[model samples]
Target: MFEQAYGRLVCFADGQREIIAMQWKQGATCAVHDHGATASGRVHLVVGALVEERFSFDGQRLCHTTTLHHVAPCTIEVPPGLIHRMTASPDATLTLSIHHYEPCIASMRIYDPEGRRTVIVPDDCGAWIPEDAAAIVAIEPWSAP
Candidate 1:
């Protein structure tokens, strides 16, 4: 188990399949990120609610696509190569969810549209950039649809 700025993570499996239980605080938002190249996953909302912001990457920049609201007792399919960020709903003090990933995510790409930078981080680091990561400025600015 690990404690992150946004919440706590308890990893159940890390072999061919990865299962992680996460507890997020109200209003806590994860960095925009994508699953590893070939990895796909599902998020099972166990408690509270979440808001997901989905994005699409053009050849040059990342563009906002849609926003989804998920309540407890629901599941969200995360397709391969999908880029998104999740925020804990303010209506709940804490949100809990289980994330299942196949072929376990080895690394993730974090996009910082405002900073105009991107960083690749290990799965253990979640969507947030680690202190040791070196961000690379994007050649083109991000956009919203």
Candidate 2:
């Protein structure tokens, strides 16, 4: 959802769940999208702020219906079938989020209202970091299973 987003999959559980730390540069965003029927997740803001916009699909078109503004130290529950997009707060310099996904995040579906096909979510997890963070050392080559 970002032009140059970065992520590090910090944790994995049985190939069915994952914890990803994602960073968004200014003006970065994902297009309107859904997490798939079998997917559910949560986003915890760790730095800066963000603005989320939810949309509704009527088979013919997508309509914007809701907007949520969040700051650091907040949590957002992401239910399956939610069509939404997010961007770093325009006034903010950058944003960071810790994301928890059930059944993995590869199940994400980017919407295409003008066509029949949806974009397959890529497995790119961005750069790897190694450091003692909160008493846990990060692993290398972190990517979606």
For the record, the alpha-carbon RMSD of candidate 1 to the native fold, in angstroms, is: 4.4
- TM-scores of the models, in the given order? 0.84, 0.73
Worst 10 residues of 1 by lDDT: 133-142
Residue 33 of model 1 has an lDDT of 86
Model 2 stretches astray by more than 4 angstroms: 1-10, 113-117, 123-145
lDDT of 1 by residue, 21-89 (tens): 888877788888888788889999999999999998774577899999999999999988999999889
Candidate 2, lDDT over the whole model: 0.66
Among all candidates shown, the one with the greatest TM-score: 1
lDDT of 2 by residue, 17-135 (tens): 87888777776675666765676889999988988999986655677999999999999999878888888776778688998878675545556444433454543333211122332
As a TM-score, model 2 comes out at 0.73
lDDT of each: 0.77, 0.66
Clash total of candidate 2: 2
Clashing pairs in 1: none
Give the best candidate by lDDT. Answer: 1
Lowest summed lDDT across 10 adjacent residues in model 2 is found at: 136-145
